[model samples]
Target: MATQLDLQEQEQLDALKAFWKRYGNLVTWLLIAALAAYAGWNGWNYWQRDQALKASAMYDELDRAAAAGDADKTARIFGDLKDRYPGTAYAEQGGLAAAKVQFEKGQVDAAKASLTWVAANAAEDEYRTVARLRLAAVLAAAKQFDQALAELDAAKAAGFEALVADRRGDVLAAAGREAEARAAYEAAYKAMDDSVDYKRLIEAKLTALGAAPAPAAPAASGAAS
Candidate 1:
């Protein structure tokens, strides 16, 4: 009985060794890969948090400069903010604020440059649309009518469709295209929501332009072509 027990124990030990020999290297490499990935993920999270904190502080400085109407300081600080933290929402907001300050100071060219940058580079589509709208207004004021219309045509933000049409009417009217201006104003009036105060302003524009709003379609049929 004792000899039989010893033989059985030796067989079990040999089987365990064979299992380790077959899988030991694979297990070791898999564990190393998992640990490496975990460390990398943690490092990336820390890096993003650090970047955002620094960007927030810089944005606050830019905001203060803009509020104080310090165009030069606003421009300088915005330059730094955009260069160092272009990926942050702070950079986009700073660009818009800087543009507003410069525009108020009659630095039209500089304002255009800042607004163009935001239109091209903002991470959010809504910000891009706002930049484009402001840029179009500036271009129109400069009598660059075709360029203003081009900018408006390129703005595809859904909620801004009415505003874009309204701006287009203004540009077309400035260019002495009266028929097209009336049509554009009508389109703007139709696009605006009924409850918006701005819609009433749009209606007033249509009234002044001698363009009547399109009659509303029945509710069951919704909007008609």
Candidate 2:
């Protein structure tokens, strides 16, 4: 019986060897591929985190430059950040910050360029909307009324409807189109929550234009910026 058990164990061992002989190379290659894929996935995740960390640091530098009011330095570092890490949220944020500095420094064209980048490529929808609104404001300040109007009209988010209307009113008022301005102001008034002090301002705007302010409704939070 011991000899029989020994033979059974040896037979099992021999069968396993035969199976390995038949499929060992395929199994080994599959295991290697799986390990390589796992390693690649880990490497990619690490690289992404490393990139985000680097981008955050660069953005901090950009913020410092902005605080110092060095438009040139801010622009250069912002450009570097955008170019090197365009996909990072920090890059879009840097664009917004740099645009503000450029605008305050009276660099309209530079600010427009930065804002355009943020509008076009920002990863966050909120950032894109803010950039669009700011860009429209700048264009309106430059008296590019049609261009500003086009930007506002093309904006897809309903969240900024009131702000867009308010901006449109400003643009129309700048162009001395009082009737259109009144209409726009009314729209803004209607869109705003009645509780906001800004609604009173809009109402005053309508009164100045000799147009009755639209009846107040519950304010939707649709103001951009």
The predictions' CA RMSDs to the true structure, in order, are 4.9, 6.7
- Cα-based TM-score, every candidate: 0.85, 0.79
- Give me the displacement of residue 133 in model 1, in angstroms: 0.7
lDDT of 2 by residue, 18-60 (tens): 9999999999999999999999999999999999999999999
* lDDT values, one for every candidate: 0.90, 0.90
How many collisions per candidate? 0, 2
lDDT (tens digit, per residue) of candidate 1 on 1-225: 569889999999999899889998998899999999999999999988898999999989999999999999999999999999998898899999999999999999989999999999999988999898999988988999999999888888878989989999889988889899888888888888898999888777777878756666766955778
Span of 10 residues, lowest total lDDT, candidate 1: 213-222
> Which 10-residue window of candidate 2 scores lowest in summed lDDT?
210-219
lDDT for residue 46 in candidate 2, whole number 0-100 = 98
- Model 1 misplaced stretches (Cα beyond 4 Å): 1-19, 214-225
Candidate 1: residue 160 Cα off by (Å): 1.8
